[model samples]
Target: MPEARAPVHVDGEVVASKRIGGYRHLTLTAPGVPERFRAGNFVAVSVAGHVTRRTLWVHRVRASSAFGPTLDVVVEARGSGTAWLTAQPVGAKVAITGPLGRAFALPKEAVSCLLVGEGYAAAPLFPLAERLRERGCAVSLVVSAPDEARLLSALEARRSARSVTVLTADGSVGQRGTVGDHVDDLVRRSEADVVYAAGPSHVLRAAAGAAERVGAWSQVAVETSMPCGTGLCHGCPLPVVGEDGVDRVVRACTEGPVVRGDRVRWDDL
Candidate 1:
C-alpha cells in the first residue's frame, strides 16, 4: 500500500452535468492536478472529511493540442456519497488525491481487446479503449446499461473502438439482457484476444465465467471504500490466491483496485 499523502486542494468548477435518466454525467475542471496522469488512473476527492474520500475513476482525461487538461467522472446521484458529489456548485473547492492505481493489463502487442463495463465501471475502461486504439489494437466495447438514454455514453465509447455493442436490461439498446449474455457471440465474431471488465462483483464473476468458457484471459477492477487509501488501514482487504488454492486477503487500496478476474476469490465476497 502507498503512503496516505495529503490531498491536493483543488477548486473544480463543474463545467457541465447532464442527467442521462438515472445517472449524471459530470465534467469537472480541477486545475491543480498534474498533466502526466494516464487515462485509467483515478483521483480521490474529499466530500465531508478525511474518512470518506470519494473515489472516482478518470472517465476521460480531456486534453487537447490547444485546450488544457480536464477530468470527467460519472457520478451516480443515487446515494448519500454520490448525491453529495453531484450537488457541489460550479466554483466549489475540492480536495483530490493522485492519479492512483495501476494500469490494466493492456498490452500494445495484443491483436484485439474486448472491454466490458457497467455504470461507473466504464470510467477507467473508457480511457483504456482509447489508449489501446492508439497503440494499434482493435478495440471493441460492449457495455450494459439500464435504459435507452444510458446507452448514449456507451455509444460514444464505441467511436474510439473499432466497433461497439450495447446491452440494456430493458431491451432498449443492443440486447435484452445483461452484457454477459452476449459475450460469447461478441468474442466469436470480433475474435478478441483479451478481455477486461469493471463493475459489481456479480458482473465481474459473470464476465470471468464467460471468458473462461471461451479460454480467454480476463481482468477486472474491483471497487471498495476505505478510510485510508493506503494499505495500512486494512479496511479494504480483498480475497486473493495464497497457497495451493487457499484464499488470502490483499488490500484493495494498495495491491490493487484492479485484479485478474480468475485470480480473485469472488466467493469470499
Candidate 2:
C-alpha cells in the first residue's frame, strides 16, 4: 500500500474555462495539485463557493513556468453542482480539496497497452497515456461517444497514442458502435498486454470482458455519485469479488474510483 497524503484545501482561481461539445473544461490555478496529483485522482470542488461540493476527476496536470502548476477538470453540467462550476467566470475563486483516491497503476515493464474512453471519461486517460509512453509502453486508444460532436479529444488522442480509433453510436464517426462493440477486435489487433478504461458501467464491463478474453490485465476507473469524497459518507460503494471468491462492498472514494476490472461485479453494479 502507498502512504496517503492529507488532503489540502486551496483557493483555486479559474485560469481558463471553455465549452467543448457537451463538456466544460476548466483550468484552475491550484498550487498544491500539480505536485500531489496522480492520473486517476479526483478533487472535491466547492460549488459556487458554497459548502456543497462535487467530486471531479483530474483531467490534466500542467506545470508552467509562468503560472506554476494548474489542475484541469472536465465538467458535464448535468446538475446544479456541476452547472455552478461551469458558470464561474475566469479569475473566480473555487475551493478544492484533493488529489484524492487511488490511481491507475502502470505496468512494471514495457508492454502494449490499450486505453478505452467514452465522452468526458476520456479526459483522464490522456495523462495515463503520456506516462505509459514515458515507460516505453506502446499505447493505443479508442475514443467513443454517441455522435461525432460529442467525441472527446480525438486530435489529442491521435497525438498521444501510437494509433487512435474513434467510434460513434450514430456512425457519425470512424466506426458505428460503442467501444464495447469494438474492444475485442482492438485488443487482438493491438496485441495489448494490459487494458485501462474509463467510462460508463457498460463500457467498463466490456473492457474487462475483452481483456479477460485476451488473457490481459485490466484497470478501470469507475464513476459514481460521491457526496463526500472520502470513505466516511458510504455514498459510493460497489460490490467486488475478492480473490478468495468472497463478496465485499468497497467505497469508490477510498478503495477505488480505480480498481482491477476483473474484481468488480459488473452485473451486480
Which model scores highest in lDDT?
A: 2
Which ranges of candidate 2 are over 4 A from the true structure?
1-4, 49-52
lDDT of 2 by residue, 17-83 (tens): 9988888999998778778877888888877645556988778888874578898889988887888
- Tell me the tens digit of each residue's lDDT in model 1 across 48-151: 64366777877887774222577778777656777888887655666667566655766748577888888776778888887788788988887887777665
Pairs in clash, predicted candidate 1: none
Instruction: Provide TM-scores for the models.
Output: 0.87, 0.96
- Candidate achieving the largest TM-score: 2
Assess candidate 2 and give its TM-score to the true structure.
Answer: 0.96
The per-residue C-alpha lDDT of model 1 at residue 1 equals 17
TM-score of 1: 0.87
Error of 2 at 78 (Å): 0.5
